[model samples]
Target: MAQPTTSILCTDLGFEWPDGRPVLSGFHLAVGPGRTGLVGLNGAGKSTLLRLIAGELTPASGAVRIAGELAYLPQDLTVASDQRVDETLGIRAKREALHAIESGDVDERHFAALGDDWDVEERARATLDRLGLTGLHLDRTTGELSGGQAVLLHLAALLLRRPDVLLLDEPTNNLDAQARARLYDAVAAFPGVLLLVSHDRELLERVDQIADLRDGEVTWYGGNFSAYRAALAAEQESAERLVRNAEADVKRQKRDLVEATQRLAKSAAYGKARSVRRNDPKALADKLQGKGEETAGRLRGMHTERLNEAKERLAVAEEAVRDDAEIRIDLPRTAVPAGRSVLQLERVRLAYGGVVDLELRGPERVALIGRNGSGKTTLLRTVAGELAPAEGMITTPVPMRYLPQRLDVLDDEATVFRNVKAYAPAATDNDVRARLARFLFRGARADQQAGTLSGGERFRATLAALLLADPPPQLLLLDEPTNNLDLASVRQLTQALAGYRGTLVVASHDYPFLREIGITRWLEWDGGELHAVDPR
Candidate 1:
């Protein structure tokens, strides 16, 4: 199929915060129909660029043009109540425009504008039902749904609009495998344009083009993430070589300039000596003029250093992304006893009004997984000694610290320094500062307000404190630990977990993260039972 004309075009686009910090500048891009995936690091102004394309914000410079009717779905959408699923779908008006059919009256110009195919309500209902919502859902309040359910509800509205272009940001977030498959189908079924932003490797594989945003510029690659990765690897190698060449050029230029400077100095001294000996005013002045021009010409060649400066600036620009260039982990170590079991629960039954058997041991890194309200978190808390099993005996290893799903462990009002201090009060001012520095929170960063930290930063600060304290915990229990972490920090934390020598148990929904850190086993949570299962 042929691609459509660019639906959105940004030429010389630039944006900066009100405080004069640059977010994106010289960002030029054009996106058309079919699938275009926007890839960027966390702070690369991706959302800002999306907002520009959506016309939600004006660019500081350059032009942004959008064509045709457009529909956009942000990462999270507010679900308005009092509207049923049927009321939200466009399929019901198969023979007429949804607005006209639903209103029972339409202006002639508007009707003509809509053209044919108005009575498509059956088609609309099928789309809704396919998404696991029913015809009765049209009358149900959308607010009374789970996160994934709410996402599906908004998607139905988007499909019904039959938009000329569609924009989705993190569309797969909070979705299960089944829901994600349905979303993929919806994207495939879209008849017009599709632009999406996602970190999902599997999702990006299906896109026709990928655009990576970095250093206030957009670099378009011809293929998916895998191709982009390959291309990036090649580009980094080239950049490194360029830097080496630039350094060599700079050094050579500096040497030549120093030599010329010395020659000019010697010439001036020689001329002085000759002028004193010749005693001829006219000849001495002539010699001075000739030497002056020669020295100036030599200095002019020194512009090579200026060119070298430009290359230096470019090198810094190229290396700005170096930190994101690789994936690495640094797992921390905590001692583990040779004892039979670090933690175990017998006949462990838990629920609002019930009981079930559960048991786990040391040397096992288990992932407790279930859909929402399945009580995966509750079971973790039970083992943490926070919540007791209603009708069973439970065993737990001491010195265990739990990182809750929400960062309740952090003190919001305190400075990051103060917060870290709270965890390890014994550390002196210098010792605490040194520990904070190890986690990349040195100097001013350690002094940053805890409330001001991003979700990822808060997790990092908490983890760093927990691990670097006076004595590390022997048992580690974490709940959805990777939820808000950026890819880089997530890799770092995963690396740390891999090296830790302790009884580990983690309850997470991040499959990739779990695999990276080497989860030893698994526990399936259903009803009120925590059953051990194979990791595979």
Candidate 2:
């Protein structure tokens, strides 16, 4: 293999939000050719850095240098309903110019538009096919495609541009298994500088290198996600060991300081008694006493300084160890008896034509798995009473709550505390704050407006509102809950779900996340039918 060429560079970059919240400062990065995975905790400025590199946001200082053309694919991709497939691929104009010139129209503008790109259509089709989009037509409207298809289409557009540097933020967020596989193949084969920010472990595993961003700094790890994890584990173990040693040193320093004080006290007393028993001159005895006191004071000061130094070292050692917090709470009100049926779907036909006959008894946890257009979301909404079934009877005897993928349950203008309070009107203010603290929104964080929160913070606030409802939901419905969450936030969510004793029906494409949440049952939605399956 040959050495890769540098394509993207950042020097002394700085950025801050309008609210005076600093995100990145003096950040420097040099990205070369090959796929690089960017991983970080939520609110760690991963997206912000990408936007800076893509020229989507202006840095407060320094500069971003790109050796060639750059293209960026964001997490939330939105195309107009009327946009045609060819238009989205950026070949509509070129195709029209090529046709006109072939038909003997001598126009300079047409020649200029078609310049050296006569095979644009063929390349577009090939790219589409490569991404498993062979069924889509050039003139098909974007509105006809599924959410996962839209994401793939956006990536196809970026590929069509053939930029030297490519930036992708959560590219596999809404994709199903097949689409995700197609995307992975594309990333593996791309011949340019690729920097992607993602929490998808599978996707991260495909990268050539890993960049772990935290505290406004980037640490490079050789090889893929697994390699990064191994390296990080080793680093953390070393840090923990250093912390332990530093703590022991501090304790020893304190003990030495106390022993020095005791020795000095004994020496001073012995000298004073000897001087008094020997009947020395009063002036001489006073001088001797003064000299002993000064010596003891100097010794005490030296010992105290050593102890302080040891404590500072301990503090620095502790700072090197990462301590990501987990969500832990009790939900006694949501518990259900083992034999009680919380939900029943009797030969039900959803509005989208999916058929299901199921019973959720006790506090069973169900994982709904399927492709993007396979009616998983439709079925979840129908079960949550957000959508009515076309046929059959569905019953939910207990209180339920639905957390949609969009997370639109809370008012954006209101504070997080206010949103939780609205959901549980009967709960006291102290009680609501106490509950929000468990979700990692304490103090002024709970007072921040919902619109101002980061993606993970917003999800936490929405979850807090749902879980803190007045009557307490016994059947919690979550749709693609891990879509935009970072790895830390995903772990936190898994921890939170583990404590919930209510029935859970989570529709997600994240297999690791689903498994981590301790799913008791698995159901696959395919061709409008629900079938039980073993956990993957």
Instruction: Please tell me which predicted candidate would have the highest TM-score against the true structure.
Output: 2
Tens-place lDDT digits, model 1, residues 64-175: 8877788888753665676655555533333345576468776675466456645455656677777765643454565445456667777877877778888887776556
Runs in model 2 deviating more than 4 A are 1-6, 96-112
TM-score on alpha carbons, each prediction:
0.70, 0.94
Error of 2 at 289 (Å): 0.9
Clashes of each: 30, 0
lDDT of each: 0.70, 0.90
TM-score of 1: 0.70
Cα lDDT for residue 283, model 1? Answer: 67
Candidate 1, residue 136: CA error in Å? 10
lDDT of 1 at 125: 68
